[model samples]
Target chain A: MPPPLITARSLVKRFGDLVAVDGIDVDVQPGEAFGFLGPNGAGKTSTMRMIGCVSPVSSGRLEIFGLDPAHEGRAIRSRIGVVPQLDQLDQELTVMENLVIYARYFDIPRAVAQSRAVELLDFVQLADRADDKVDPLSGGQKRRVSIARSLISEPELLLLDEPTTGLDPQARHLLWDRLHQLKERGATLVLTTHYMDEAEQLCDRLVVMDGGRIVAEGSPRALITEYATREVLEMRFGRGRNEERVDDVLGVGERVEVLPDRLLVYVADGESALAELHARSVIPESALVRRSSLEDVFLRLTGRTLVD
Target chain B: MITTRILPSALLDVRSPQRLLERNAMVYRRSWMVIFSGFFEPLFYLLSIRIGLSALVGDIEVGGKLIPYDEFVAPGLMAAAAMNGAVLESTMNVFHKWRQAKLYDSILATPMSAGDIAIGEIGFAVIRGLMYSTAFIFTMLALGMVKSAWIVMSVVACALIGFAFASIGMAWTTYMRSWADFEYVPAVTLPLFLFSATFYPLSSYGSWSWVVQLSPLYHGVVLVRASNLGEWSPSLVVHAGVLVGLSVVGMAVTASRIKTLLLK
Candidate 1:
């Protein structure tokens, strides 16, 4: 088999006395949609910056396309596209001018750059705003323009940090569709997000990160199954009684997590678990039976929610 | 094992800075009023200082040569104009892009390195400085400020002066934390403008002439004046050397400083 498109062994990044990425290891094969799932300040952006060659790795072995990033940053960066956490578009220039000027950094010929800019603008559905300055564009349009700018170099690997953090649902769906098309064309993707649904929808394989460490690594389904039961029964009997009644359904499932607002019974069959709860005369204000998700797995590993 | 080689690419890639210059050109194309408005500052100074102040103070001597008050200060104004344009472009414009716009973050993602940004920004500053100098020089020629063919070479001098200060300005700006720190720019350059043997001869200061000798603007004024007067001296080499040396040292420091700050 050919080597993985990216490889990192004991990669470390430090900012002064703080260790942002503390000796983690990861590998990504070509054409795979890989993800880093973490909450804020979980070292996801730090890791992405090292991979992007914009931030220096304090110590570690990192190779992109078999080229050492520390030594050949320019060469490595030429093959990779980075959509930073923020939209860093030039507010003073027109949307098309942003892409064209970015292409100039790679020494793309003017005519070729213009044609590619036109095509990319069409791809992002911003062809009509090509002549307009970026400051007046809507948030979604600005993000699409940023994505278009990233693709101007036709990079082999695309790195997106929180690509859909603040987008409306419609905008996010459109971005997902555009990214899905890119993946279908065999472009390798690496992304980081706190959105579990986004990870489940996009990543083929991923690692769950917390506090500068990888707590779990697997496919979404594998992680959900391994870290949690096949289903979860959510029972809320008002705040005070929810905790008191937890012991009544103790043996109905493999494990139970008592949250402040509800009780979660982990079981292979949530329907049967709910029946058992009713037979025991434990009536709640509301009850829900649903399949397990990555959110459950994250809660199991970190003992906290992803967003808060 | 991994070893890093700093700036593995060629030192001072001309193409990158050229592209940066092109980007600025496109941006300014839409805002031609800003460029047109820059022309009036030096002319205003020439008319106000030369016509108004000269009528009261009379002709002055510089470098042991007596010349008309307007003639004496025209080249000095050109040099000051070059310094102003270069400093403003490099410091304020570059700082705004780096801090507020975060434009460099996007540019750095490409194959361009920190050095490319430094060179590119300086190149843009030099282009603007030359434009302002050209306008000032043409006005000087119209007002009978040109005494010889050597005035043609003063444009080159203006460019050099711009290059020197632009490099230094870019380097200095990296050390600035915010817009509040920019007050030092006018504080420093204004004094260089008013007291650098620009308005009068070194003899005006008498024993304190040593102060003018220490100012970079003094060398700039002498060089531009000599060219305008069709005089050449070996001392011109010293003046030109200072600007060139400043540019080289400033560029070197700026490239590495940007790398340290951004690539960390």
Candidate 2:
């Protein structure tokens, strides 16, 4: 196997007294799509900042493309593209000018930058709006312009922090498609997201983080297989019902979890568990059988729900 | 002393700094109206106060020569315009880019350092300030208000004044938390611009002349006035030295603050 394109060894970052990023280790290979899956304040963005070479590591070692971030920050930065959580496009410039000016930041020739800016605008489907001012573009269009600006340098490694947090579903899918195309062109991509579907769809491998520490790491499917049952039977309890204990209703399942508003019975076969519940005369307000997924694994590993 | 050698090669990298300055020029190009708005404020002061008010105040004696009141105030107006243009860009524009637009955050991700950013911004501000000062000087010459070609020296004085203010403005911007903090800048600057012997000579105030001498703008006005009258003296060298000293001290403070803020 090839060496990892990015590596972090016992990385730690502290903002004042609060440890924003604990001692976390990660390795991401070239041409691979890696992801940090976590909720807000889970240190996902902070970790991405460190690898992007924008924020210095408070402790431990970080290497990007086999170079130390502290000693070779400029050399490393020149070769990497970063899409920060907040869009930082020059509001005063036109959409195309934004891309062109960003190219200048990397010292790219003006003629080359202009040509590349047009190509990127076309790639993001913003060619018609190229000359339009940035203030008039919709949020989705602005994000697309930002993404295109990042690619102006033709960076070898790309770091995206929560790429589609506040976008509409259609816009999110559009951005995901663009990112997927970038990955197909052999760009090493590292992204952070709280959406399980986004992670499952884009990431080849991912790490789950909670409270600044990695709780688990694996492929989405493998994580589910390792940490969760084959199926999850969600049984919602009615209002104020002093219902029967979960042990009486879900005794046949391998494991049962009694939450405040629902009971989850984990088993190899969800159908049998539902039948057993019916046989025990414990009628739930609602019942559903669903295939196990990363959401289930995250819930099981961290808690009952994802906190933002 | 933080020697300049270890400050980071990124600051000395001319490519990115040139790009950033060009970017600011492009913004000015698109918003020429906004840029001219700053230029017009001083012109209005010159026309309304210097030209119009001159009829009431009559001619004034300066450097043992009888000079029109408007001629004496024209150089002061030019000097003040340079100071205002540089301060506006270095303070409000810099603060907006740093806080509201997050423009610096994106630039910092590139091969640009905070020091490069500071220098580029000050360079652009000085360029604009000189443009305005040159125009004002020509206007004074056209009106038969300039007694000698030495008035061109006022343009150079304007550029130095711009550099000093821009550097200090950048240093002050680092301490600003919000737009409300900017109220103090004009509150302090307006009083200095009005009472710093811009409209009248420092000697006119008698003993109170010492108060006007304390202002940086007073030094700028004195230098421009002396140069306008072709009356260069050793004291003018001292005035230039003071401007240069302020610029160096301000830039040093600004560079250190930028490293602390951006590198953190």
Candidate 3:
């Protein structure tokens, strides 16, 4: 529907000899919450920048809202909002001034900019701190200001590069709530994050990227089902003793993933896997049974945890 | 060859540079002290010349004409003042915003291009320079230093000088990789201010007068001094052309540098 809001084919971005974004294809439909999930230096930010029309594509074809980024960046950028990884809030201006001036960049008249700014600050829960400079605000409040500033343009699409990288749990939940409201209001969101929980909570469909390439792409549940078992049994042994019973723990489930401090057994039923482990006479210091998640899918696909 | 098209259309873009200028003005409004701080340096140099330096040399001769030492030194300081105002904005302020604060990164996230940022910044610095030049020339008038009606042209000359320096200063700043790189700002501008025929006539440089002409500030000093004393010659056009050419080159360099650095 709507012919996909964005489409990229063999998209490549290179900085001299270093290829940050290798050839990758992507499609994002309108009204969809799509994610680029990966660890650091996965070229997720590069892809977001190219889509935001701020960074030109080094090679390959990219179209946003049916316009080529290389020649029609201003046109494409006008209808999209971008929240950069770092809080780029204007330290010199008050929080309110930051939003108002950002509106002016999209050519919104002053009165309209002011009205929208007031409403947006209220939405981001920063209405009380409107007059204060950004330097004195908490990291969360500064981030909220950045979000409000991005929304001032009333953009059709929003690009968030690590929307919640360095926030406390409560602040992240608050941001998540605001983003949920935006989704309910029919805003198309494209975000990049290393947090599997953030991706699970926000993105409807996502691609797992590693070393500048997409390893997997699907809905959270679909990816876990395809790449992981229904439940995972994690048993931790003495720090350096996990390797001693590694062979005995094999074949207890569909497969096993060994972490530095623990062993993860993928199984349809965790209690049965525990019974089998007990039958093997290998007692663990601690054992946990939890449902499989995107983290599991990431581990299955990339052989590395999402956050690392 | 990255061609920076500083086109009329870009200037006319409704959303552009004016918004950038407005942001700068808003920042300055809250901290009037920063503006006044840059304001006082040129005046101190002028007044010190009036009270101290002028006492040592009563009058100086230039271009087959003799003028008060204060008159000769006033325009040089005025030009330097304008240059200082523009350079401060384009260099250190830009350095902070680009390096420390990362403000330009935020602006680039919007529809505003690097060219818009550069032009907006240079425009504001030129405006700041004009304000300083206006105040300085009027102060010269009050001190009875105005010798001719041509003094009105000094403001235009200062604006040109400021634009040239602002553009070049911004280009130079993009190459600064660390805080220590900024030491070159004062090291270069300080000596250039003193040696650009500001306190002494270019002929004082003797055989080195040709080298003096090569300095961008030398052309600015010549233009300001000639305008202040009502001295007219075809060389005024040459000086103005030099500034204009430098402005263009600087703008191009700054545009390309910002594109490579940020948009990478």
Candidate 4:
């Protein structure tokens, strides 16, 4: 309702002769958690960089807060926080010093920068290690420090590029909780991730990107319902036999996706599909019936896994 | 052609660079040994040349004037130290932060631009050079090397030399792809320091005197030597002009190069 915090029209980014981000359009409304989901080299990072006003757009129109990124970069960058794909924390400086100096970049007064740094370190649960240099911290702690540093400016919008790419499960859950709290406080978030579950958990709406193009865009459930069925029947046969009799289970569901070790049957009722498979004497080594998810929708649209 | 705006309002946003300088100061506060190590390098060169080498090489002629060998070499060493300080910060340190540490990548995400990073880095290099020069000048004064009131201008000369080297070093660093590329820095700077008349008169290398004159470090050595001995001449203007022009051109190239590299 607040006139879309960001809008990109035919956004394109080229690195010499390689077109990293092809023509695409995106609009992120205020207070929304939007995601760009894709595998490596899908141009998610390029799109995020263009939105953050750090990378120049090779050709196209990008506007943040109604200002063009090419000419008004400083103005736009001042109000957005970016957590780059890599943890660019200053290893030479203490964790607390990192946040304090970042705060100063926004021209925050010294005393304010110090105090805010204290609070942010506490927020990221790195207060105990505030005096320690980043080199000694764990991967998760370093990421938390980077997140805290990005928040030093109290930005209106936050751009997180692959925020949880290399973290453990627990660390990711912790970061997701922190991000949820931020969203609850009405902070707009734009994140890129290859993790389907991360997108389902964090993004209110997301677009699936592949080879520099958007293949699908919708909320998790809406995408599932539109591109997939209500439930999925997964049956895995012994390694060499999974694809042997694939045609024997043909019309049991709306569609069937064959993977290396399993067969995914998309149907309105997975339990009935399994029953039909049994009735047809197509016994599997293992069978599972569960609700369809974004993973199914993604595979349906792109014909490729999100992580590959 | 890309817009060649000098100190464009985009770059004139000085607050970000100020922040970068503060960050370096904070890091250095904890690692004082790094600063301490830099101090002894120039001091050792001065002590060895003044005490040991000066015994063999007595008074030397410089700029049409005869001065004590220690006096002539001290200020030249000071200028060389300025070059060393600036080049260390701009080339190796900047390259490390850019390639290995990714420090500027984080800074550029904020309101700071690549120009801010380059300026901030050069500003810190100048400050470090000033620290070394101030300490070197003090040591020279303690050794009774001050010849006239014009010696005060050496501080300004040191800062100018540092800025010129810092800008040029940073511009060169943009092209470095790996650590192997850094070997050229020492290979080039070492020869210039030895041949810039830092230890003996440029005339001693008769056939190589023109090479000495061509070295930027030589101009710095001449500038600081003239200021230390109160030997003002129109040549001082030429030395100052060359250093200033080098700084301006280096800075302009560095700014644009950094913009292209990081903002790509």
Worst 10 residues of 3 chain B by lDDT: B1-10
Go through the candidates in order and give the clash count of each: 0, 0, 0, 0
lDDT of each: 0.87, 0.84, 0.88, 0.86
- All candidates: TM-score: 0.95, 0.93, 0.95, 0.95
- For model 1, residues A1-308, the per-residue Cα lDDT tens digits are 77999998889889999988988899999999999999999999999999999898888898899998877888999899889889999888999999998898898998999999999999999999999999998888899999999999999999999999999999999999999999999999999999999999999999999988899999999999899999999999896777777778789998888788988888999998889778888888899999888988988899852221
Model 2, residue A213: what's the lDDT? 94
Report the C-alpha lDDT of model 3 over A200-273, residue by residue, as the tens digit.
99999999999899999999889989999999999999798876667888888888887889988889999899
What's the C-alpha lDDT at position A62 in model 1?
A: 88
Q: Look at candidate 3 and tell me the lDDT of residue A94.
A: 94
Which candidate should be chosen as best, given lDDT against the real structure?
Answer: 3
Give the top-scoring candidate (DockQ). Answer: 4
CAPRI-style docking class of model 4 based on DockQ: high
TM-score of 1: 0.95
Over B1-264, each residue of candidate 4 has an lDDT whose tens digit, in order, gives: 244355544344445677778889998887766764466787898888777888787777776677778787888888988888888889989899889998888888888877778788998988888788888888888988788888889999999999999989988998999999999999989988888888888878888688788888888888898888887888788888888888877776777777777878
True-contact fraction per candidate equals 0.89, 0.69, 0.75, 0.89
* 2 against 4, candidate with superior lDDT: 4
Tens-digit per-residue lDDT, A90-181, candidate 2: 98788888888888888899999999999999999999999999988877888898899999999999889889889999999999999999
Off-target runs (Cα >4 Å) in candidate 3 are A304-308, B1-15
Candidate 2 chain B minimal-lDDT segment of 10 residues: B6-15
In candidate 3, residue A22 scores what lDDT?
Answer: 94
lDDT of each residue in B28-103, candidate 1, tens digit only? 9888668645557767989897667877777676556777788888898889888888888999999999989988
RMSD of each: 3.1, 2.9, 2.8, 2.5
CA lDDT, candidate 3, residue A45? 95
lDDT, model 1: 0.87
